[model samples]
Target chain A: MREMIITNNPLVVEKYSERVLFIDGSVEQVLIKVRDMVHRKHGLISHPLPASLRVLFSPYRSVIIGRNNGDINPLQVEIVENSILKYKKHMDVREVDKENNEDYQMIDLTLLESALKDEQVNSMLSGY
Target chain B: MKLEIGRIHIKDIQFGDSTFVEDGVLTVDKAGLIASLKEDERIKDVQVDIARPGEKVRIIPVKDVIEPRVKVEGTGAGFPGVTSKTTQCGQGRTHVLYGAAVVTVGDIVGFQEGVIDMWGEGAKWTPFSKTYNVTVDIQVVEGLEVHTHEETVRLAGLRAAEFIGQAGKEVEPDEVLTYELGGMFEETAKYPNLPKVLYVEMMITQGLLHDTYIYGVNAQTILPSVMHPNEELDNAVISGNCVAACDKITTYQHQNNSVILDLYAQHGKELNFTGVIMVPEHTTLSGKLRVADYTVKLAKMLGADGVIVSEEGYGNPDSDLLMICKKLEDAKIKTVLITDECAGRDGLSQPLADTAAEAVAVVSTGNVSHVVTLPPAEKVIGNPESIAVLAGGWKGAVLEDGTMMCELNAVIGATSEIGYHNVTCRLY
Candidate 1:
């Protein structure tokens, strides 16, 4: 299955290279791209929202989305759409805390690395 | 499984020539503890500090808080797999240093570390503020990666708890509580007319700093597994995640899980407590579907008529919680969810990211995004500047005059989904 990482974190772009869809803006910008692509049948491989609410205020984000040739998955579209709204609602509390954005960027990359870890193990198990 | 828990009430903690408990006061050899904890090559320095209730003390960037306990009649002692030999727990006589806690403090490893204030306004928000705290300030080797740094501090807290747990081994508990539940079939036969209830605990099992350990195994690597309630009581699980401190299940909360204790309080009288299903909140959608399906399957296997599901973190986990709730209710298993709402600061935002018509009975454990103002502390442990990077804290969070302002998101145990903290909403 072909997948791509849509991220604003430079660390992810530097590590993943070819599979990266680097976004040069904030986390919401990355999710905007994701919602647009999922509308075109690019299904989400990872959940759109960050695991915790605190990181929802982070400036960086990385989402793994699988490129699908079939019709849009309603569940995927709903998740993406709901997540964008959720992030915005949370942003009502305050803007992204970018003062320590380097930490946020690293944390975002770690979450991306976490999603890629299972893929690496699966690939090794398949002996590819 | 049946286990007896003995509690030795500790009134205060103070440094002394040696570590021991006398007349409810826990005397610790600060130098000795620092020496033992400093044995780890990853740790450069360790400090032993005491923060009692009503003191003007603040501990920030806290990693994990653990209760000191010793197993006198069990096979697995000292957290079993993580800090000791891999052995089954929950079937033994465990003694708890009831009011005392070992709090690990260090440099900021992630954006989710939290604060515990021991006096005045801050004390009311966090449950840890009331405990007689023995703070372990650990300074790890410089330039260590964040992942290793988290583990290094996590292990230190466990080790310190184990060391202090030894004090309880020789002392008599003020009271002993017994938790005994027979096999599923035996319990069903015993209470044929009662409804079977299951508790499904969801742990954030994403990558890096988000993880939970069961008997030393990473929970994310395994399918949703059914565990005996006693296993949880005996230290079978521990938190290794940095999921926002407000709702993160600290190791102390796991040792004395409020959900498990409340269910046990009604184990036989009302509902036949079936068991627990430790569910992992994965970051992938497929993983969510698979685990939710498996959780429902387990609840059905237990013949659960009702189940209480509690979430660990928020946002992405709202989907996981409702997915599991939807699956269980679809199976005709009445479901109730326990979660903290991120209703934003004004409490106007929708409580959860995802919802299900089946989730009609959700219990809100306060709102994580509720902003709070705390007065300045006379003594601050760890770096106060750490508040700037906290999930609930902004750059100017540490105001002049030593005052602090943050969301319940950064306050430890403020909005615990497990009903462990003091935050509650009373209709006026």
Candidate 2:
């Protein structure tokens, strides 16, 4: 199944032009789009939150969402909504740091690529 | 597999002409080590400094901490896969420069680098304070990409430790501890009446700076796999993190994993120590579900009656932790979990990002958002102003008088989820 790459990371946008939904904003913006998509019944292909809560300080973010079937995935909705809560919880206390956009963009791009590797495993495990 | 660790107690470190250990002190060949590390063209410059216990020294924006060790009687490398050839470890004797650490410091590649105060109120929060630290402050060549820069420092620290670990190969250790775990069937039969306990170690595999490597393979690329405890003890797992400082397990911690140590202590006496199933915490819901199911399945396959699960990093991994816990409990397996919380500044918010009714027994290492004030250090090793951008820090956190205020989130090993540090929580 094809996946949607929702990101504020330019590296991701440049690499995955076809499926990338470029968000020209903060990390929260990319996540919000994922939540909105999930609410509209898209399944969460990748986790919205980065590996570390600290990465929340970085400006760049990338999350993957899979295509929706006819019905909504309760679990996908729950994970994405909870992911927003977790991000807001951390951000509520500390707003994203002042700078380091380049470094963060690189980090976010790396994480996005890491999540993309799950596709291979998914394909491998689907044998009848 | 069985491993015998010989500890050469290192009380202090000093820069000298040659690198070797003698009479509780480690003399480092600073120039030689730096030259060896600089062989990697990515690193432009490397500076070596020492921070011992009770010093007024503070190493900041630190990346990774590795304990130096060398295999005296083993056929493989000290850190297989990443730093050396992929050969089986834990089959012979290894020497450790105990009470010492290779502290990697540099400019922040990500907001997750941490601080280690060698003395004063700050030292109390970090386990690195007690160890004689050999700080490797790396400067990557200008124009190098951030991701490659992070990797440069990571590999440099490993090479530095491998170089320093050579000192232990010839020294007579003050203490020799043995770690041995036999075949699963044999061990289970040997302690047939004991409760079978498995260890589920959740590794962060989000990306470059937020991943753990097992025998050189990224946890992100592998499934939940069974590992002999001895392999980890003999320097198989290495840390690659730039995400969270307080709770992220360093390579040093992996080499001296408290969970593995405790389980081995009670391997045959109190419980049947089955083995370790190293699991990766993923970013996608599908990935998380797949991993959680695989982890529980591996535990069941081992026929575990009880299990100890330790989480690395927090927030997103929180969901993975609970999912695995819920599944394990649903399997009728008694599961006890260890983790840290981000309960806001006043400790008022919920501890984890996700929760479950099945998570009945959980240990809170400490709160990530709990703020602390660290007094000024006479000597600050790395960048002092970098705190403002750290995970647990904020704007104006440096303060006017040099006294810094931040959450435990910025302190190294303050809230180690593996029970390696001094964060205590009790419920009455």
Candidate 3:
């Protein structure tokens, strides 16, 4: 059997005893016990817990959870991978041409900053 | 010496009773005693060869003395003509008379004769006492000579239209045109020391005019009207009859001291000659580029002579100086570099201190025909007279009270066969 707990307070670490602890299944039973212990000791639950967390830890126990359950969903990861692939493809094309290869090199950012501040830079840049 | 009846003398001389002898000489003791001798009965020629033991020797005459007559003559240039006359008496004596005349002092005149009265109721002739008459004269002469030159040329400031009117009146193609630059003339008038801006306006209404060859330094603007004048002189500055139009431009490094380079560049299309642009060494790169652009564009459009870069910093490095020259050359413009090390304490540096030998070197290396530098007022030495002669003549002639004779000579000598261009004079 596994248990899960969720609380608004970050200083509830001593009750868990173990530094690295993971909980799975029977989230409802664990929340009820934690709530009862907090009520008996503190007299009241000052801050409200998240409604989503309450629902997941309600009387409904033995729920089936998916592997992808965190904030980073599958759709976000796919989008990030597509952007990296596109950048690599662009770099590969630029590297194939000798004329375009120079453009791929990184410019000295400090030189660009100084050039922007110079009054005559705009005139010279326009000339180029 | 003579012995008359009124005059007394001892030892075969005439004497009056009142005229006593002292040391064997006749002496006059009474004023009126000489009147007795005039009566012919008192005494005449009373001779005495000797004096008694108790008598005196020297004799004094009892008569008033008469002043001797003198004669004078006049000579030299500018003397008037005159005459003389004489009258004779029975005793081989003649009276001389002189006519009115002018003579200088120390002049000699002939003593013609001596005269006694031979006419009159009681006129008589006696042995005449010798007397001479001399004539005196006075004359005047010039002390100093002063020479001056005037009535040569007449110059007047006129509007563009006036010059056009005069140009219309010209029947010949080679006739000279004249007009004045108004603002320059006005500014020059305000400053007491600056040179006068004499503007010559040329009217190019009809003929095909070569701007450079037609209007030298004196020519400035054009006019729409032949009479009513406009003060917009700068816009009217067209290239006169010369291959190039150039002026010395001085730029300072201090803020707010920028020169209006556009004023010169505006007429770039009209100028056929190069612009000799000068820049101070310490001027910023931005300022140098502006000058360089102005010069390069004008030179490209017109024909740039060259760029002369001068460093006013006394201790500026030669490498930096060479770099400026190199930059100008890289721009495809000819470059001449002047170092400030030779500027000296007299405030003149660079080309001014360049000797003839150094000037030759600059000409050869820089490939420039003309060089500009300050007048050597600091190094100049000698008396002003010698300098004046060396300068070929005085830059200006002034009267004691500081009156300028430049205009006078210009007006007077303008029409003469000989022309005076740069001579200046002052008159009080």
Superior candidate under lDDT, 1 versus 2: 1
Question: Candidate 1 chain B: minimum summed lDDT over ten consecutive residues — where?
Answer: B386-395
Q: lDDT (CA) for every model shown?
A: 0.86, 0.85, 0.20
lDDT of 2: 0.85
Candidate 3, residue B2: CA error in Å? 99
Candidate 3 positional error at B346, Å: 8.2
lDDT of 3 by residue, A11-52 (tens): 222333342122332323333433333333321111111101
Clash list (residue pairs), candidate 2: A46-B284, A47-B283, A47-B284, B209-B242
Query: Cα lDDT for residue B108, model 2?
Result: 46
**Model 2: how far residue A35 lies from native, Å:** 2.2
Better of 2 and 3 by TM-score: 2
Task: List the DockQ of the predictions in order.
Answer: 0.63, 0.63, 0.00
lDDT, residue B190, candidate 2: 94
Give the lDDT of residue B345 in candidate 2: 87
- Correct interface contacts retained, every candidate: 0.68, 0.72, 0.00
Candidate 1 segments whose C-alpha is farther than 4 A from its true place: A119-128, B108-112, B390-400
lDDT of 2 by residue, B1-428 (tens): 77889999998889999999989989999999999999999888888889989999988898999999898896667688888898999788999999989999987464545899888888999999999999998998989876688788889999999999999988999999988888889988898899999999999988777878898887888889999888888888888886688999999999899999999999889998999999998887778888999999999888999999999988779889999999999999999999998888889888888878999999889998888888888887877656556533455667788777888888899999999997775679
Candidate 2 off by > 4 Å? A24-26, A120-128, B108-112, B391-396, B426-428
Q: Which run of 10 residues does model 2 chain B get worst, by summed lDDT?
A: B387-396
lDDT of 1 by residue, B1-428 (tens): 88999999999888888889999989888888888888899999888788999999889888889999999996888898889999888887999999999998886544555889898887999999889999998888999988888889989999999888898889989999999999999998998999999999999888777889999888979899999999988888988876588999998899889999999999778999999999998888877888999999988877899999999998788999999999999999999999999887788878899878899999999988787888877898888667666533445766787666778888899999999999877988
Q: What is candidate 3's CA lDDT for residue B177?
A: 17
* TM-score, per-candidate, Cα-based: 0.96, 0.95, 0.18
